[model samples]
Target: MSDAAGTDATVEISTDGACLGNPGVGGWGAVLRYRGKEKRISGAETETTNNRMELTAAIEALALLTRPSNVVIWTDSSYVKDGITKWVAGWQRNGWKTAAKKPVKNDDLWQRLLDEEKRHTVQWRWVKGHNGDHYNEIADDLATSAARNLRDAP
Candidate 1:
């Protein structure tokens, strides 16, 4: 865990999600930064969707932050980023239903993300995938590794 950039002691997280098929093996990866150093965390599910993996990556990353701090999160999933930063308030006002009057998907993970979000001041940024960003590439690699592991695991 070496400091790649010279930033203050704040948490910077980058997450990526991968799925073999729409409802097939999937995985998520997150790179957590603190004091210029990084910790990589990832997991996989045998049967899941890309959206779930995306939300799971963010959820897992936020869970790693033990204390409230100025946090920056970079994600490739618009759903995860937009859902929290934009749509969450309206959803809450509407009793967790979408604008189309449909129940929100992944309510559990969304609740966890919202809870963790309340505990910290987070800045969400959407990054384009496969754009040669170092942290984003690392997260993508970790996610693909997790998906491969899931497929090979007994």
Candidate 2:
């Protein structure tokens, strides 16, 4: 992340993902805060998984940075947090395979996330979903609403 943030500007981001079903309409959202300013971004997919949407939220959040930054990301998905912070190196070393010698699901999104992450110092923090966290709640609402809109699209 040294290259991602040439200066010392720090950004706070909260991200969440939602799906109508495990492999159904999905959406992702992120709220980015920097120096008292906030920006919200969200998108939906007609067919996707929750994990993909979660990963998309992170990737999109990082992609929004115009410059390198110290980014602290809050997420509710352990799969996202652990996969990036803990298991990514192993997966990469094994050529994107899991410990059980299985092809890693959502490897494409993982690669995109890694690519976006390289441009910033990213710290992933996991929060419990559906709790009272304000930022997380907003992000969750954004995602769930987007997904629902797409699910109910005419």
Candidate 3:
């Protein structure tokens, strides 16, 4: 899609992540929409954290785009939003260290997310999880199903 200004138009996306245990089996899901078309994608990991899953959702969603476009990404994770939009610059400047000078957790994923983010113009929006938002609920279901699938796998 292209805006009137000749720039790539915005694609709306909703993403969510779920974990069977905080540091155990986890999954991420995303829904993307543009010009009345939609796509859903999801994946799971045998061992991970809720935060990692959350970040993964956004990463996977953005990575699916075939071209650089403006994107509005809806997520329930303040950590993903704040960490990327607010804190990442400082973390990069400090060699990926937190305020306490400790190494940042999930630095690898964060770096990957940042790399994917650079490919597009993304606006991060936060929605309350499980609050009955249609897309959010759908993404949640996808994530939960992925987690369950992984857990049930031999």
Candidate 4:
């Protein structure tokens, strides 16, 4: 069941992250769509990195599924995409350490993401962001909005 944009191959989800500065105010967003209905979710952090936001977006998206189903996740973050699809296994085998023998960054979120991922079959795809993809654009907007909201919060 694919959408007009060929995004419905499975329940299609897209996520984005934004940070005012590398480790400043940050936010993450996710857009989930299935059978014509769409849901958007976003959150902000007082201080965080883009990678953490990216992982948070993916984690939140998967958490929304709530049922066992195949899914395709689209994201602009190679860190999120590659980290889960490529590096996770090795990390698990190596006691969650990186190739450089350093502790993996964002281990908490990464572990949570791994746990949530087990609830569904997920395929990670990289999308070229800011190129006007509908879901991707929506996600980016939500992330920016969240970041702005965080910055403006009293």
lDDT agreement with native, every candidate: 0.87, 0.91, 0.91, 0.88
Ranking by lDDT: 2, 3, 4, 1
Model 3 has a clash total of 0
| Model 3: how far residue 115 lies from native, Å | 0.5
Candidate 1 on 49-111: residue-level lDDT in tens? 999999999888888776676788999889998999889889889998999999988888889
Clashing pairs in 2: 4-68, 4-119, 5-68
- Cα lDDT of candidate 3 equals 0.91
- The TM-score of predicted model 1 comes to 0.91
Per-residue lDDT value at 62 in model 1 = 83
Better by lDDT, candidate 4 or 1: 4
Q: Clash number for every model?
A: 0, 3, 0, 0
- Compose the digit string of candidate 3's lDDT tens values, residues 1-154: 3331236557899999999999999999999988788899999999999999999999998888878878999999999989999999999999999989999999999999999989888899999999999999999999999999999998
Better of 1 and 2 by lDDT: 2
- The ten-residue window of minimal lDDT in model 4 covers 1-10
Q: Per-residue lDDT of 90-147 in model 4, one digit per residue for the tens? A: 9999998989999999999999999998877788999999998999999999998999
